[model samples]
Target: MPSLSPSSGQSGLSGRTPPSPSEALTVYVVDDEELIRTSLQGLLRSMQLDVRTFGSAEEFLAAPKVAGPACLVLDVRLRGESGLAFQQSLAHRGLAHLPVIIMTGHGDVAMTVQAMKAGARDFLEKPFRQQEMIDAVIGALEADTRRLAAERSLDELRSCWADLTPREREVLGHVAAGRMNKQIAGDMGIAEITAKIHRGQGMRKMRSRSVADLVLKMQALDVIRRAA
Candidate 1:
């Protein structure tokens, strides 16, 4: 196994701010070599990042899930299962959302292409510079953070959608489709004032500031679709 000790090079993480415990991020390292694991653990811990090490892919999978955003730093070669195969199996293992950084002692252009195709966030050759590893981990964490935020936003939007009454949804849909209140009332066979009331309530429930905003949210929720 290639030694990835950070002591040999300057670390860029020293002056960075660490996240609080509640919002802490994690980095999982899966490598068969004990020295590599220990070195990485020490280096990341100095920066106050939560780091976990596993000897094999199976070990990491069997471990309990950690809360908050995290990324995986995986060695390409392992005793039991190669990192390439494990990376490909992440989606099947229900870890498709997890970002991965691939590292190898022996790397080739073909191997790098394969890892990228497998959705790895980065690839590093062994004996790589310490700053390179740190940069990759930081990039992966940033990407995961954006992904989690989008997921949460979608969930909240879905919850808001579920709270809407059927009539309210219909009114909102008409508005999204560019119908006026009178037109909506005609479409739903309801009074114009009733249509206006439902439109107001629906917009309030969806927390929309304007008709255009409502339309955008509706599109996001698939309440309306643009022409192909």
Candidate 2:
């Protein structure tokens, strides 16, 4: 990933500057206070980051879904609906995968603990240092990137697995269970020679170069089971 730098020119309601051309991070700042929002926007932009400011949780929600690597820096307090409530709503709606950093003026140890439990990537007190905020943002973005990559890989694995024939799938299951060809043949009521052929074909279709590779792929797909 490339480093981010701050940019000049105040944009949005907060008057926060934009990110520098060199910065690659995209950050969304949500706070009801215009001053705090603008300050954060400027701070981040100076670091060469892409910053977007939202006046409320509703405004943030109204924005389109983020497409690339990004994180949300959300305030703990908001008018009408609380930030914690908004976070819960996102989780309930299956949007918890998006990384979030909770910022609170009235933050306490208990609140921080609760936010961590609720899947916040990090928690920042209102008077936090610039370095602290930058570190949290970088950490959150890195985590989001890794998570999105994992999800994509899992989807591709599922699609590939779905292309297998029933017999191939059965062979895969036995192989993942550590069964040898002779043992699999006995279990399936087939000769060892027939089992070997089926196993070879299944391995080829699954694109597994070795038994270890096949087993790892099955584990990644969550299809490998331990014997009771």
Candidate 3:
């Protein structure tokens, strides 16, 4: 069966606009069948997604890396090394973050469950509906986009935290924990005014406008645990 067989009624990837260059999404298709790879590539490209096709898992791993949000569309049965095994090995290959959508002509409940458990975002049977494939690709891309964004935010937060003085960090933590300036000062054996200075400095460095904002940022950075 063809990897992507557009049903007669389906028009095209409707109502979907390509993301901005800065937020471009990519999809890598791995199917041993040249026809399947070509078909899937054409369909995904119509949506303006960056599509790459590989004949085998090794070829995919050896390909020059494209940095940014992307997902893989893998067939369960490949020429060598089954897709499920490849999915399980992704973490070791530095692709743990890559989302995968598994498709196969010889699928079963057991296969679907195995794929899902291995972190496949979606499972499709061969000759799948074009719209179904489109939806799965879109969903995978969106998930990867969110993951990249969250990682970026976390990195920025860590950089900001790294810039704070040790004293400032201590005062900020206490402040985020709802400690008053005097209490923080007493705990640190410093003057209340000194504690206030450190708190203000830390808040500015963290770009937090208030105690609540500081608390939220700290919680996101895991500098302070969330309240039970």
| Candidate 2 vs 3: which has more TM-score | 3
Q: Could you tell me the lDDT of residue 183 within candidate 1?
A: 99
lDDT of 1 by residue, 1-228 (tens): 446645343545553444343568899999999989988888777767899999999899999877688999999999988999999999999999999999999999999999999999899998876667887887788788888888888888999999999999999989988899999999999999999999999999999989888877877888778657
TM-score on alpha carbons, each prediction? 0.93, 0.80, 0.94
Clashes of each: 0, 8, 0
Cα deviation at 39, candidate 3, in Å, is 0.5
The CA lDDT at 128 in model 1 is: 76
Ranking by TM-score: 3, 1, 2
* Predicted model with the maximum TM-score: 3
Task: Kindly provide the TM-score of model 1 when superposed on the true structure, using C-alpha atoms.
Answer: 0.93
lDDT of 2: 0.78
Q: lDDT for each of the candidates?
A: 0.87, 0.78, 0.88
Candidate ranking (lDDT, best to worst): 3, 1, 2
lDDT of 2 by residue, 10-48 (tens): 231233233322326689988888888888887777767
Candidate 1 off by > 4 Å: 5-11, 14-22
Q: What is the C-alpha local distance difference test score of candidate 1?
A: 0.87
